[model samples]
Target: MTYIVAYIASLIVFGALDAIWLTTMTSRIYRPVLGDILLSDLRIAPALAFYLLYPVGLVVFAAMPALRSGSAGTALAHGALFGLIAYATYDLTNYATLRSWTLQITLIDLAYGTAVAGLTALAAYQAARWVAG
Candidate 1:
């Protein structure tokens, strides 16, 4: 029950923030750098899957620990760490395999992921505590 609430809260908050970042910020920032490699039309399926699935990782790795400890700080720290690792995995793999991938983009993405996940986890943990009470 609580876990479900936490998951939903994390998903909603993170998804919204990520959407805003993608539409308003990242598109402009990356378009110039990625240029031709940037798809004009986004593939909805993978984007949707990423939003839906990524929250599960947050719930399990960050929210759960914070809930158990009754500490939002725990969520923030763990969530940031989780984000760093997860984003690094994607970006580093791209850097390794994709000729078009850049260190600038990878660094920017890693920073964004870390902040977004940490903040989302904090919000989710707080929401769960509110719901539990």
Candidate 2:
């Protein structure tokens, strides 16, 4: 039950933040930086999949452990680490394989991912604790 709560909370928090991030960064950062490579439209399936599933990773890797430890700090730390690793992998892979990928994009994405994921996990952990209490 706590785990379920954590998952849903993370989903809501991460989704909301990521939505804002995407909308804000699309034109100001991503589009300008990756001009010609920008897609005409987002592919719904993969986008939906990412939005839906990313929180599960947050819940499992960050929130759950924090809940067990009863420490919100744990949530933030674990989440940030997870986010960094995950984002680093994605960005580094793209930079390596795709000519269009750039250091600016990779750095921006890493920062965003680290901050957002940490915030999401901390929020979810707090939500779960609040509910449980």
Q: Give lDDT per model, in order.
A: 0.90, 0.91
TM-score, structure 1 vs. true:
0.94
Best by TM-score: 2
Please tell me which predicted candidate would have the highest lDDT against the true structure.
2
Q: Candidate 1 residues 1-133, lDDT tens each?
A: 8789989998899989998988897567788877898888989999889888899999899988998999889999999998999999999999899888889989889999999999998888888888888
TM-score per prediction, in order, is 0.94, 0.95
Which runs of model 1 end up more than 4 angstroms from their true locations? none
CA RMSD for every model? Answer: 1.1, 1.0
- For model 2, residues 1-133, the per-residue Cα lDDT tens digits are 8888998998889888988998888899878768888788999999889878888898999998998899999999999998999899999999999888889999999999999999999998998898888
